[model samples]
Target: MKKTLTVLIAAGALLGAAGCSATPQLTNEETCARVKTVVSAQSATSDKAGMTRVANQLRPIKAAASEDLRDPLQTIIEYFDEAAKPTPDTAKLEDMKADYSAAGQTYGQVCGTGQ
Candidate 1:
C-alpha cells in the first residue's frame, strides 16, 4: 500500500511539473514572421476552402502573440472571421476591409514592410 501511494504521488508530481511549464509567449519578430507566413499562404490560395484553412491556421498564432501584437492579430482574425460568416453584410464587409487595411498599415509600420 505504501509503495503504491509513493508511485501515485510521483506520478502526480510529474504531471504537475509538466502542466506548470507554459509555452513562452512569442516575440514581436517571431509574431511578424508568423503573420507574414500566414499572409503568404493566404495569398497563394484563391479558393474558399483554402482561405478557411488559412484562417484556422491563424487562430493559434493569434493566441500565442504577445500583448503588443494582439490588436493587429485580432484585426486580421476579425477580417477572416467576418469573411467566413454564412450571411455576409455589405456594411460589415466594408468595415472589415477598412479595419484590415488599417491593421495591415500598422503591421507594415512595425515590421517595416512598406506595404
Candidate 2:
C-alpha cells in the first residue's frame, strides 16, 4: 500500500510540473494579428491630447510585437510618446520622425505594410 501511495504522489508531482510549464510562445503570424489590431487604432491626430490617446492605444502593440518587429514597434511608440508631450521640441520631433520612418520602412519590408 505504501509503495502504491508513493507512486501516486510522484505521478501527481510530475503532472503538476507539466501543467506549470511556460505557456507556448506566439507565432509571428499570431503576434502580427495582435499588432494589427493595435496599429489600426492609431490616428493622424496632431494635438497633444489626440497624440496621447494614440500613444495609449499603441502601448499594446509593443507588447504584442514579434521579435522581427519589436524594435520598429518600440520606435513607433517612442515617436508617439514624444508627440504627446505638452511642449514637444520641433527638432527632436523631426529626429524622432526620421527614426520612426526608418523603423517603419524596415517593418514594411518584413510585414508588407508601412501603416
Candidate 3:
C-alpha cells in the first residue's frame, strides 16, 4: 500500500510539472511571420469560401497572439468572418472596410511589413 501511494504521488508530481510547462507565448516577430504567411496565401481569394478560410486560419494565430497583436488580428478575423456569410450586407461590408484597412495598417506597422 505504501509503495502504491508513493508511485501515485510520483505520477501526480510528474503530471503537475508537465502541466506547468506550457508552450511559451509567441514572440511578436513569430506572430507577424505567421500572420503574413496566412494573409499572403489567402489574399487572392475574395469569395465566401476564401473569406471563411482566412478567418479560420487566423483564429488560432489570434488566440496564441500577444496582447498587443490581439486587437488587429481580431479585427481582421471579424472582417473575413462577416464577409464569408451568404449574402453579406453590402453597406456593412463597406463600413467594415475602413476598420479592416486600419487594422491592416496597424498590422503592417507593428509587424514591419510593406503591406
Q: Which number leads on lDDT?
A: 3
The models' CA-based lDDT, in order, is: 0.79, 0.74, 0.85
lDDT of 3: 0.85
Per-residue lDDT tens digits for candidate 3, residues 35-109, read 878878936378888778888888889888877788999998888887888878889889999999998998888
Q: Provide the lDDT at 46 for model 3.
A: 82
Instruction: Record all residue pairs in model 2 with backbone atoms less than 3 Å apart, i.e. clashing.
Output: none
**How does model 1 fare in lDDT?**
0.79
Clash totals for all models, in order? 0, 0, 0
lDDT of 2: 0.74
> What is the TM-score ranking, best to worst?
3, 1, 2
Best by TM-score, which number? Answer: 3
For residues 2-112, what per-residue lDDT tens digits would candidate 2 score against the true structure? Answer: 999999999999999999885555556775676566556646466777667666775665565677877877888788788788777879889788889888787777776
Off by over 4 Å in 2: 1-25, 42-46
